[model samples]
Target: MAIPAQAPPAEEVVADPVPPPDRRRSILARIWGVYAIRRIVYALSVVWLVTTGTFFMIRAMPGDPVEVLAGKLSMSGLTMDVARVRAEQALAWDPNANIFVQYFEYLGNLLRGDFGMVIGLHNTSVLDHIMKYLPWTLFSVGLGVVVAILLGMGVGMIMAYYRNGLFDHIMSAVASTLSAIPNYLGAMALILIGSTWLGLFDFWDMRGRISIGVEPGFTGEFIGDALYHAILPLITYAFTITGGWMLVMKASTTEVLGEDYVTVARARGLKGRRIGMSYVGRNSILPLIPQVALAIGTLVGGAVIVEKILFYPGIGELLIGSITTRDYPVIQGVVLILTCAVIFTNLLVDLLNSWIDPRIRKEGAST
Candidate 1:
């Protein structure tokens, strides 16, 4: 009724203050925030411990490399004293020096990637030897792992979806059986079945990277021969390795399949295929990524026994040669590389796991 309802009480409109824009963290600080620095420190410590331990352990073995080299030279008709002196000089190391001093000297050279001359390779640089053979392992074993992992993910997804059905049962049995067997056993089996001169198929050569006369280059013909040579060992690795991946994936997928979100996806009218792939498959496969990274790193060492059986010119074979001849520098160099792989892989896995899994990131933040 009142003509002018008493003007609404003068409104006091206080503006809320704007939050200050977040200050950007420095690069190093950002890295530390992500726990990268912590992981790196831990990795470096592990590497140091392993390096020192290996140096001492190898040195502790009775009868030094000099003595072993001398003995070998003696067999080749060199007199004992001459062989001993020659070995000492070729090793370029003083047996009389303190071990701690020698260790520091070795570490220094390692930092420069100078492994010294390899007595096993008749005065070749140990670093040079690694450079030569590392690529072979990288090509064969490394590529095989990639192939196996892809196949594993596919098979695992299918197996999980079929859970307990005919396909799943068959795969589960096969996977369990293969996982229990050592990889080298697969190599041996391939030898028994595929080695042209010795195996059932006798379809391919058991030794050499390419045919004897093929010129070593990027030529198509040479590539074909090398691929032919790699086929059997590659198959052996893939067949045996995929089992573990399949088992892991199946388990992870099964667990994810029962998650509330997965159920929600289905209830929202999503196709079963859509639910499996977009919901369960994506979530389940997250764990495998770290494992795959570790596996790739480990392959740097090459499957030792398998490589031995295959007679593949890989790091494993190089390691064996170094040990047999007591090539101290070469042995240490290979061990150092392997140790780095292990530590680095662990660090990478941790970092990736924390990045990808919110729960892991939360835990890391809390710590």
Candidate 2:
């Protein structure tokens, strides 16, 4: 009993231990892991494949591009000798060089954005023409796509919320009917009604950016005129494409709404708006990311039917004219540009999907 006072029960002392160097090394190893390097390499490989494959495919197409240009020039009353000289100079087509050498030169020119002259259009560089018309196509079709997506998502969400109620049934029927109709067919019908019946838009004598009475420059007047001409085509695209989005989104939303988490959210007595925004919208909208990306590509490339029908000075018309004239330079440029656009769009959607669904990213990392 007397000795117990001396030891004070031999209390244990705890130390604040520091992490080992091996643990720190492990964290650093993970931070700069193989998965990150692999992703970067994968992306670069895709870019290389697209660029090289595009070049080869264009080269493999039938008919000499130089000869095509010369033929087009001759049609415009240029002498054969002069046309051949100009074509050779423009394309650098040496009679002495082999096919591989010619392909390499063409690839170099393409990479430099020198697409040569548009065969049918004198004094117009193919690259310049594409850049000039691309904005109009992008602006008009892009607006239409946005409108379609917004309206589609709203109506689809409402229909899904009601399940098999009257709202759902009505939307399903309308969407089905519209989706069954082709976009071009719908465009033609709208054009007939718009021009013949309602007389809202002018059918003929709608040439250039503005009315002939107004002078053309890069002025607000010209832009306003261009936009005035664009409205019908834009509306046509939206009307034709909306049905597809509505049906797809409606089906997706209904599926998402049936998930267990949605039921749990409901049972928890969460506000309807809160539950919808956080759970329903989040899950249902994942598929829309790819659709939106594809729409972006289509928008930028121009609507072939809508632009052709409306006679809009956009890429679709440019492509059409090139095809008719066998303008190889323009055709190759457009195809390459569009192919790159589509690939990039898909890549962007893939990245977005990984962001939205962490499971995808995790799976990728593991691989």
For residues 157-180, could you state the per-residue lDDT of candidate 2 as single tens digits?
A: 888899799988998899888767
Estimate, for each residue in 119-138, the C-alpha lDDT of model 1 and write its tens digit: 74576887788878777776
List clash counts for every candidate, in order. Answer: 1, 0
Worst 10 residues of 1 by lDDT: 19-28
Q: What C-alpha lDDT does candidate 1 achieve relative to the native structure?
A: 0.79
